[model samples]
Every structure is written in C-alpha cells, then in structure tokens.
Target: MSEARLPTLFIPHGGGPCFFMEPPRGMPDPWKSLGDHLRGIGATIGQQPRAVLVVSGHWEESQPTVTAAAAPPLIYDYYGFPPHTYQLRYPAPGAPRLAAEIRLRLDQAGIPSTGDDIRGFDHGVFIPFLLIYPDANIPIVQLSLLASLDPAAHLAVGRALQPLRDEGVLIVGSGLSFHNLRGFFTEDPRIAADAESFDQWLTQAVTDPDPARREAALTAWAMAPGARTSHPREEHLLPLMVAAGAAGEDAGTLTYRDHIFGKAVSSYRFG
Candidate 1:
C-alpha cells in the first residue's frame, strides 16, 4: 500500500486554557463549537498521520526551530486561568527524529533552523491536540515561527517541508483569523464587521483556484479588507502562510468558520 498524503491544516485555538474549563460567569463557552469541529479533524482527513508537525503562533524565534525533546512537557502559556486549568495536561510524546528531519529540510532550503530538546508543547499545540487527539498518543513535533513575521519567508519554510506530507506527517498551523487583543472581550458590533471583512478576503484568497493568484493574495495580505483592524500584530496570521506554502498546488477548503469572542474565526485545509 502507498503512503497517503496528509493534508495541511490551519486551526484556530481559542483563548487560553479556557477551552478545557468552564466559561466565565454567563458567557457561553466560546470554544465549544470550535472544539467540536477540531475533534472531528482526523476523521475529516480520513486517516491518522504518523506524526504531526505543528506551527504554533505562540512560539517565535529569530530563525525557524523545532522541538527535539523525546518527552515534551506542557506549557501553560496563558494567564489568570482557573487553578485546574493550570494543571491541565496533554502528554503527547515528542518526535525527535521528526524534528531532526525538519531541521534537515529547513537547512536544505537555506532556511536557518535549530533543534531544542528543552522546548515544551505550548497551548497552541497541546490545546488543539487535547481536543482532536485526546489520547495524547500521536507523536508531535512543534515548529516555531520566525520573529520577522515575513509572509513570503514563512511560505518558503512551508514549501521546504512539503515532502513530509507524502511521508504521513500532518502539518498544522495553529492561529486565530482575527486576533486583536484589545477587542477580545468587548461586545462592540464593529468587531464582527472588521473580522468578517478580513475573513471573507482570506476565504477567497486561500480558496482561489489559481495557485499564482492565491500565493499573490497571501503575500500581500495586509492589503486585504480590514487586515490591520483584524490583526494589530500579524504573528497569529503568519502560520497560515506556512500552511499555504506546504499546500503547493493543492486547493484550500474552508473547514471551520464561526464567531468566537465576538470576532469571526475560521480554519482551512489544503491538499
């Protein structure tokens, strides 16, 4: 039997450790629907990957980096959560061999990268996996975004790792479509409008049938409608670039779309 080519995913990880806990006061659990969607992701893809390479928005380095630990720990990486959340764990084992392979691929592409055995799984990786693969059984290797936040550069990094897809490695970019911290808890109606404008543009760009046009649109994403209003800082949005690059000529599909914390959020799958 031939190895199945794994699809690249861009997932929205909701606020903090709250996904594993109850909502604040009367607020509906913002992560409930999103979590449900993510839990079904493995089935949607039709097979379990040998390993998962996660590009988390939470971790950034001057250069690309991969976690090299054999048994990675959990990073709470959130603030003011309830006591139980602080103790929440997703004990997924690390894939050091896979990390080494990532380092090799990045180096071959002339994208500088390092391996860190000390790095742990940040909420960006653990939270989503805790829902999607609660057994914490799949081997995972976390990749870091570059501090430069250049869309083209991140895309190049993804392209460098494209071969991994056929080798049964699922590349997942974890981030939020609209990540303005200032408007996080606010009930202002304008927030939804701003998020929708950006989300719509992104939807069209990623799902564009023409590969050239799709790449071009993503390269100039800041020019999209309400781009700046949706992402005051573009770190959270950069992961999608990596996911798209690895997508190569594969078409993108909007897998999940919903309103979270008063903003429009979406998830995408490529090839």
Candidate 2:
C-alpha cells in the first residue's frame, strides 16, 4: 500500500519455459495460475520502477556477483523445451550503473562482490518477466546467489541491497516455494501433502509479526515441516531469505499460492 517505496518480492519463476510452451496431452494448463499472478504484478505495484534487481535461484557464483552488461542477452538455461521457447525474446536493457552500485553497497557492507559483463539473463529472470513486464520497458540487473547456498548469507545480501527499494528499484527473488524435480512428475498423493505441509510452515514463518523470529525461522528453514521433501536442494528456497531480509521491519504477505504439477507453491510480497 506504500507508494513512495517499492516492495520486495519472492516469486516463483515457473518451471523452465513452461509459459511459452503448451502443456502435455491430458494435463490442464499448469502455468495459468502462476502466469496470471505474474501478469497482474505491474498493476499490483501501482507504478513504474526505475529498475528491477532480481536474485534468481538459477544463478550462483563463488561470491555475490551482478550482471554488469548494458544489454544482456537471454540465456535459455532451460532444456528439452520447444525451439521457439529458446527463441523467446525479452529485450530488456541491463542496468550496469545499478549493478555497480550494488557491488559498491555490498563492499561497503564488507560483502565481497564481483561483476559479470558477459552473463546473460537466465530463464529465471526472462521467463516470468516476459509475463510481468511484457514490453521489457524496465531495466534489469541480476544478482547471483553465493555458491555457499547458506540461508543467512543470502539474508545479509538482501539487507545490503535494501536501499535500492527507496531508489525506485524493485527487488525480486525468483524461485519456487516448492521445487522438487522428482516430486513434480510423481503421481503419488503424498508429495502433495508434503508440499502443503511445507507451505503451511513457510506461510507461518514468513508472516510472523516478530521480524527477529521470522529471520530465525527462515535461517533454520531446513527443519521446517516437509522441508526436505519440498526441496531436495536448498537453492530454490534461499531467494526468500534475501527478500525477507530486505523487508526490514515490514512483514511479508502471501500473495499467491497454488498446486502446480501437484505441489503446493507460493509467492510473497513485503513492503
């Protein structure tokens, strides 16, 4: 509801290029709900942003890294999709100045950072963004996750980048709440139950009124209900830490939640 400052977001970037491709023979369109949720984002925010700083689950580096290219190309990181999906274009300009500012902020905070001028926008940024900002009007710069994959480390990263929100930059963490490749294809009902169990725990943790307790719960997220079953690896869940950390005193609201590929997935917004 705050207009002067933009909120931080933790969103599901969808499975690969699922948005551009059709669903399998008998399956109902699995991407609709998430896609619609994404499409409504521009209106939800209530104004245009100077740029978007995205931390995608797909990109990881030795240190915290930012894409410093002026015009970053799309990196079709996903595979086994239609050829046209590879041909999809976002054409959003890259924000090198903002990237440099990010590096500066991280360094000021004693967080060693680097920049990659050649790296392109991976599927995590382009896929959901093709729906979120179709015209590619807003500039974007991607921040790579630390190779350590430590939850508290990412939270620190978010805190380092929080000032960008007041400077008209939208901070978004692109990753699914529930991401298990094996669970996505499995037909057993237990997976759904497991995802929901994790989802419930995640909702409670993020929405907690006490910010200190919220961060503590997120830092120790691996022990939450159905945590391991929801994410065999922790990469997909770590982005939420960054978003939550940037939130400062603001509490998070569950903006979107649904069962896709039979797993409960959700998105969060913090202002």
Candidate 3:
C-alpha cells in the first residue's frame, strides 16, 4: 500500500527566540500558546514525515535556492535578545538528496533553482521546528523565496514541488500572517480591527472550494481589507501562496488562531 500524502502547512513563526526565553514581567508570552500548537502539529498530520521542506520568510535569493548541506548549521538570525539565544541549537540533519530532487523538479518546471551546501537554518525554520520536533531527528531542507517576491512565481514553484508530499516530505511555509515589525511591539486599538479584517479575508480566500477562485483571491490579496496594514511588505504573506498552490484541489482548514501582542495570527493546513 502507498503511504498517505502529507498536508502542506502555513505556520506563523513567532518573533525571534521568543520560544526560548521567558516573557519579560508584565508582558504576555506571545509564543507560549503558538509553541504549544506547533508541538501538536504532528498529531494533526497523522504521521511523521521522512523530511521537511521549509520555505522561510527569512531567506530570500535572486533565484529559487535549496539548502544542500549534509549537516546544516543553525543561523542565529535575530539580535537584541539574551546572549544564550545566540548559542541555541536544533541540530537536525540536512536533506541534501531531497534538495537536489527539488532543484531538478523546479528546473523541469522552468523555475530554475540553485543549491547551497553551506546554507543554514534561520529562525524562521528553527524557531517553529524546535517546538514541533524537539528531538531534531527529521532531516530538513530550506528553500529560499525569490527576491522579486512575486506571488505567481512562488505559487508555480510550489506547484512544481507538490509531488514531494506524496514522497513523504512535509512542505511548510514559515512566516507570520501579520508581520509589521513596528506595529508588533506597540499597543494600538486599531491593530485588532486591522488584523481581523485581513485574517477574515485570508481565511475566506484559502478555504474557498474552487481552486480557480482561490488562486484568483490569493493573486490579488493586496486588495483585501487591511492587506497593506497587515503586511507592510508582502514577503511574510507570500509563503501562503506557495502552500496554497501545493494544495492543488485540497481544501484548507484553519488549524490555529490567536491574538498575539494585540494582533491576530493564524495557521492553516491544506490537503
């Protein structure tokens, strides 16, 4: 019997190293519940994947690229936190063979991708994975977003890699749904309304039954309510396009939702 296909995921990786540190006095622990949700992701999927393909908001390249290291390094991509955060480790093995296969698939799809044996796992990949797979046993390969940040192009890339799901690779897009850095640290009453507006629109778009309509909605996501307010630059939002593309005819489910720092954040699964 064939193995069951894996679902694609769009996960909101919380702010840097927040998962590893205690929330300062009087501050709500933004990552605590989200971290718990991530820890329970495997149960939702029903099985352990052979490997994970992560498309992180942190890594952007001129062209699509995959990490090809045999033993990938950890990248402490964030600053201004406790010193110990810089020394944290995940130590998951690298999926070089899977990376090569992904590059080949992208090339066949006319996407043209490169491989980097030296690339490391940035916080976007590690922060969530630390909670989801604390043992660090599963191999992981990281994919970089195109520097152009074109939604259509990334969607096509995801379409090209959809076959990996059938081959036991879990594809994950690691990014925050509401990613305005300046807004996250402040308390603004309008933030709730803006985040809810955008989140509601996003929930509708991703869950639309018709694939054509879903693609259309995502392609024009900038026109959605509070779209620009939720995402000053769309890099953080682009990952959803990829996850949706890979989803193909599958329907999306809102797997998790929370109010973090007074702004709404969510996660979705497609299968």
Candidate 4:
C-alpha cells in the first residue's frame, strides 16, 4: 500500500530571493530561526514528492492558470538586490506531464483552467523550492492566482486540485503572511499592531474545529486590527484560502511563526 497523503502548506515566502543564497539579508534581525524553519519544511512529508504545485500570490491573472512547461526556466523576478543575487540559480526540472494532470483535474472539477507551456518558475515558486527541495529534483508547476482575488474562488480552485495530493503531489501556497510593503518600515505602530492582531486571529481560525468559526474568522479577516494596513491588497493572503481548502476538515498546525520588522507573521501546515 502507498503511504498516507502529505499535508499542504501555507508558508511565508520571505523577502525577495534572499532565502536561496548564502545568507539572507535586509531584515532588522538575523532571521536565524526563520532560516532553520524553512530548511525543515521538507522533513514532515516523510518522502520525496513526485511533483509540487504552487499557487503563488505573486502571479495573478485575469483567469486561473497553471505552468505547463515540461522543463520550465527560472525567473529572476526581483529587482535592486546585489549584483551576485542575479547570478543565483535553482535549475529544477519542470513537470509537463504533471501539469497536464493538474489541468485535467481542474477541468473535471468544473473549475475553468488554462496552461502556459513556456512559463517559467517565478520567485514565488522558485524561492521556496530552493529551500525545501534544494536538489531541484522534484518536478514543479505553478498555479496563478486569479485576478479577482476572491477567497472563495481560490478555495474552489484548491478543492479542484485536492486529488493531486493522493498522487504524491505537494500543494503549497507561496506568499508572505504579512505583505504591506509601504508599512513594513514606516515607524507606524498601527501597522505592527494590525499585523499582529490579524496574525493572532488567523492562528485561531485555522486551529478551530468548528467550520463556521473558521469561515467567520476568514471572512472577517480584513477587520483584524491592522489587516488592511498589512495587506493593503489581499493577493498574498488569498493563497491561504487555497491551502485551507485543500486541508479539507483537517486541523492546521503552526509550523513556523515569527515577526519581520517587529510585525507578527506566521506559516501553517494543514493535513
């Protein structure tokens, strides 16, 4: 018999492409714990995954789309980093076959889907993979967040992709838990406080046994203390909805948690 299906993850992708290089930079603190936390993400899976499907908050489209390349290229999507950072590479092979499987699954589930054979792995997809599957051996495909950014629609997309979990595919939502770019360093107490309040609320929401409570928490998520200030726009936060949908009644666990620039942030693993 095959092993049990692995849990899905909603991780804070961290800043830029720094996580992939020798030592991370730009944060006020050393981020030692965060680095260690990222390295340990693969161990919980118990074995190597056949393919990884990422729903990146960074890649949004007018409609839901998936990367369909057999051997997708790597994209250096960030700017203003050091000169050497541009030369970094992960070189993971893409999974065209698995991409077809994803398209088929989503189609059958009544979720309209499209694929781009030439699309490469953006930072959202590559950064996390560089840490979890550093060998770049596992096949990877990325799913774009739809333009609407509706939490419900993303959840629907997750439900459509759930069957892939049984086929040894690890589904991950790659986005930062806190992403208010302007507020990150503005010396504004409101930003920090709001981010913290929303973070606490999210933790409780995912941990709750009651579906109604979880739904309520998610719906009201924008109201949490510094919710809008931290998110400004909700693309990054939307990926969480997809992960939660894939979780399917399983309770979520706090896999990683920390603060950036004195603002609270966290990551979750849902079985």
Which of the numbered candidates is closest to the native, going by highest lDDT? Answer: 2
The segments of candidate 3 whose C-alpha lies over 4 angstroms from its true place after superposition are: none
* Model 2 regions lying over 4 Å from their true place: 1-3
User: Per-residue lDDT for 212 in model 4?
Assistant: 56
TM-score of each: 0.97, 0.97, 0.97, 0.93
**Which candidate, 2 or 3, would have the higher lDDT against the true structure?**
2
Candidate 4 lDDT, 126-177, residue by residue in tens: 8777777889888888999989877778877877887778888889998878
Q: What is the C-alpha RMSD of each candidate to the true structure, in Å?
A: 1.3, 1.6, 1.2, 2.2
lDDT of each: 0.90, 0.92, 0.91, 0.81
Segments of candidate 4 deviating more than 4 angstroms? 20-29
- lDDT by residue (65-94, candidate 1, tens digit) is 899999999988999877898888888899
Which residue pairs does candidate 2 place in steric collision? Answer: none
Cand. 1 TM to true fold: 0.97
